[model samples]
Target: MEGISTLLSYILPGHSRSVTADYQFLQQSWLPTMHFQASLPRLPVPKLEDTCKKYLTTQKTILSPEEFQQTARNVDEFQLKEGPQLHQKLIEIDAENKHTSYISEPWFDMYLSDRRPLPINFNPYMIFYQEKNAAYNSPLVKATNIVISSARFLRALRAGLLEPQIFHMNKKKSDTKLFRVVTRILPSRIATYGAYLFKAFPLDMSQFENLFGTTRIPEIGKDRITKDPNARHVLVMRRGYFYTFDILNEDGSIRSPHEIASCINSILNDPREPNLCPIGILTTTERNQWAQNRRHLVDIGNADVFRKIDTATFLLILDDDLVSEDFPVLVRHFLHSDGCNRWFDKSFSLIITGKGWSGINFEHSWGDGVAVLRFCQDMKIDVSMRPHFHPEEQAHLPSSSPDVEKLDFKIDDVVMESVNRALKEYKHWTLERLTTKHLLHNIFNKKQCKNAGVSPDAIMQLSFQLALYKLEKRAVATYESCSTSAFKHGRTETVRSFTEQTKALCKAIVERGTSNVNNKEYKKMMIECSKTHAMLTKEAAMGQGFDRHLFMLKRIWQKYYDGEPPAIFKDPAFTKLNENILSTSTLNASVVMGGGFGPVVEHGYGIGYMIDDTDLSIRLAVASYKHNRDASEYIASLISAFEDIERILLSE
Candidate 1:
């Protein structure tokens, strides 16, 4: 009967658990200190002719003269015939929905429908190097400190007390012309403008464990994510064991850092069996498979329990300490979910090691890296500000504590078979298929590029072009993410990184070695490439990018035109130009926060880079399914290319 009850606990979907806080307290706490969404401007649709012209101009650099002419003809016909009608339709839709751009729904749909597994494909982790002091390195100390800091950040977020981020253009170093006036006109605008910080919870806990009960359960297919409306606990995983404890007092105030530290100490001292179910591994599987498995599990017994476990406020993992602070070692355990740690389905998972270094792996579907980065920065600042927790302090703590549930699963032979299968698949996807490279180059950084009459973005991009050309022997259509957060609910636009100037620069590097590449012609071409990149970046930032406009137009065509695909859509050049062979983003992380993500396309490389005073650091990822996609070789080329570019500029 006890085993059956435990089995029933694992499969349930919903629970009748209620937690209460003072209504007046919550009402007063919901103060809007940061009105991130107030008076935010909506994205304006781009002019059809201008978009068409820019599209042709960008393609000229990538395609051959003959190919360019064919594309040019296609563009002209599209502009004259279908483009006008599509533009009108978009305008109508934009007018009808004044709150968001016509393309916003499509963009949102595109992201949600991607259906990629989280680990190496979508969810990216931010790595934080630990402080030198050894006293704050204990697992319990780090865990409790992190919880207190994180809880504070969460409370701040809920109350809108966290100051909204604002971006202003620089006069001395503007990416576009009229930057001085633009800076004055724009003032301080919120990012993802008009978009509030969304709080997504993954589910409920046992009735006895109300406030501190959040569960992360694995089903057959897409694991369940649910949260009780009033729960104030965090889920913690360490050594394949899960523990939940309340961080909030009954009156709704957050517990003191010391109190949280005591709870962590108590948790660490408690003996627990290894996770027999290891249900979190199911999250690492493909969504469809997981969803199917979930249905099977629910049918077995506790449907309500499974649903409750699905919705937790957030997830926290206390990982094992590593001796060396290598990227590979950190990243391996940071993202690994086979059996050791984590239910990867949460909106964000904060991973802290016993060594004190920490990082985050988050589901990309919830929000972009920028939003999460802000949250991370807040946590880092909070943690650094707080004093260290001493182990001796555990003696002077509360005697009676909130109950921490050790969730047990009744696993039959069938379930064990499924677990083994998931383990095999997850191992291949993470350990075998995905390859990561973190390069810390001691080359010229932002300052050097500025001195060389180029934007840092342009130089970084040009280096990638050169590297790709070296590896693949030709240019590939590159998609660089440009934030459109200047406008309300603005997400990202594709800044077509490949250009005629980039091709020219690549050609110069290939034809002339680094020592002899300092000619006036080559220098001119390099600067031009940088200028072109800068212009596109500025345009994209202003919500006037080419790709999103074209994407919306194509969707409109599909919606209105009740016939076969148009000539523009069928053009081989059109298909070839949009293939994202090199998907990259300049995350531009600060010293406090660093983010890394996987490739969008299977055969392409996902590159996240950051530039500092005298250094350039990059995290490169490629799918290992393709035997030929050598990320290490590409990194080598990237290093060589950047070195050559630096040498060429300094040679004269």
Candidate 2:
């Protein structure tokens, strides 16, 4: 068996030999960078009393007095009796695991295994518009520039030339260094591999000659990725056809933009048959479903083609031309509703449309938006500095006509049926699940927030809550993501946006319209809300949020305690308030690259807002099922709420 395993390792791309070598190389290369990962404090088990107190306070507004009293009793009993013992056990567990975060393992497991539909549920997008010098209509020119820039940035990252992300303390004088948790590798057939190998950005200058393009191939239910380590080409998807073209010079340096443009022109102009079944649509299926289908596909010869596609540097999507500046058309390409223009499983894919407007759709599993934003900013700067070529420049460029390889799968009757099903399901899912709205508010910008004596974030958070109240006529459970990346492998903590002050302000604004609003009282209320918002946000950032702490405690009780479930855990009031109706986050990125995700629950809205000095942009997603709620109408209500609040503040 060992001998067979060894023989198979020699044949497979990321098999036993590669995994062993990769692990050894990873240990040596990452040892220097793991100091912070090692030195970071363990996720602290906060005093059960404090956590219970905070939990009770969060429930006060949502629960009736009698209901609150019952929850209070349950919390008191748990804290006084079993909580201390559980805390001790959790401390012991933390002490036992010294290398990684206690929450880190479970967090990742939950993220990957949740099996939600990707289009709007878990995946987020960032769209970059075509600037004066940045826009390139030709796929070859755009893809080459993006690939080269990405390679340089990634190499700099591995070489430690780029600055590590430091935690910016809100009030403290000094910035604290955080764990650099970004990984550029995307997962492929996670269940089959049980682990993924991180691809090292080409290090040696000459090594770059053998590398060119990488791609992800979608199977019936699951998807596999491949790359050609010895090939210097990139995968291009246009009008539902796939082709590969080289992007590197013989010596490994990237070819000139003009040369790449010529290669792309030849391929696009040359006639090629479209795919029999748009297999890329299967990437749109749920993870486990895809995995099951992938098992069946292995019997076919799709594995080798997939391996070649996944080995490329990255996937570059060349969309059909869009001459109009209509925001909807640009969004259709970026978000990619039904077209076969995207392979969504890649860690990151650069999408260049016909109008030269481009953006990125990235898998959230690899890294957060911060790292991707930095890369986007670098690309923007690089494009700005690049010299544009004239029409005559193409004639003078080097003529290296590399054979553009065409990679395709053999779609039998079984595979063809799956493909059709996927296309129909994905098309309907997009029409129902993904919706976009842009708000450019002249009055509710950063300056307006300051003049109104409130933090911009707090104002926006309150506005979302207020809009929900107006629309639903009740306070809804809301979530605001607070980054805890200050700690090792830290991701996020949930900050409850529904506060006492928010509740009061919403009621007041509803009763007294903008005409009869009280400026002094409203200003005073908003100021208090701002302070409360800041305090909760600070606690969340400090790893003292209510959700994770309670989650761990419940898990501990289930593991160690032999008694029945705690009343607090089974209480209806607690369960009701815990249902997240509005999953919101303030992800501040360049306006062009800012994007959002779908709400976690079916009847909820995912709100990603960016508040600039002069304007505010919101990316909203909601399930368009049965007209439960309309995202556009909600945005209008939010706009009206902002207007009412501003009017009340300035009336005095």
Q: Which candidate gets the maximum TM-score versus the true structure?
A: 1
The residue ranges of model 1 lying beyond 4 angstroms of the native Cα positions read 1-33, 170-231, 273-276, 302-308, 321-324, 335-340, 387-402, 516-520, 559-561, 592-594, 614-626
Error of 2 at 69 (Å): 3.5
TM-score quality measure for candidate 1: 0.82
> How many residue pairs clash per model?
39, 17
TM-score of 2: 0.80
Residue-level lDDT of model 1, residues 146-260, one tens digit each, is 6766666555555444444455334234323343233324323432221222221101001111112233333333233344656577776766666666776564456655667
Candidate 2 local distance difference test against the native: 0.61
Given candidate 2, what's the lDDT at residue 179?
16
User: What is every candidate's alpha-carbon RMSD to the true fold?
Assistant: 9.7, 10.1
Consecutive 10-residue window with the lowest summed lDDT within model 2: 195-204
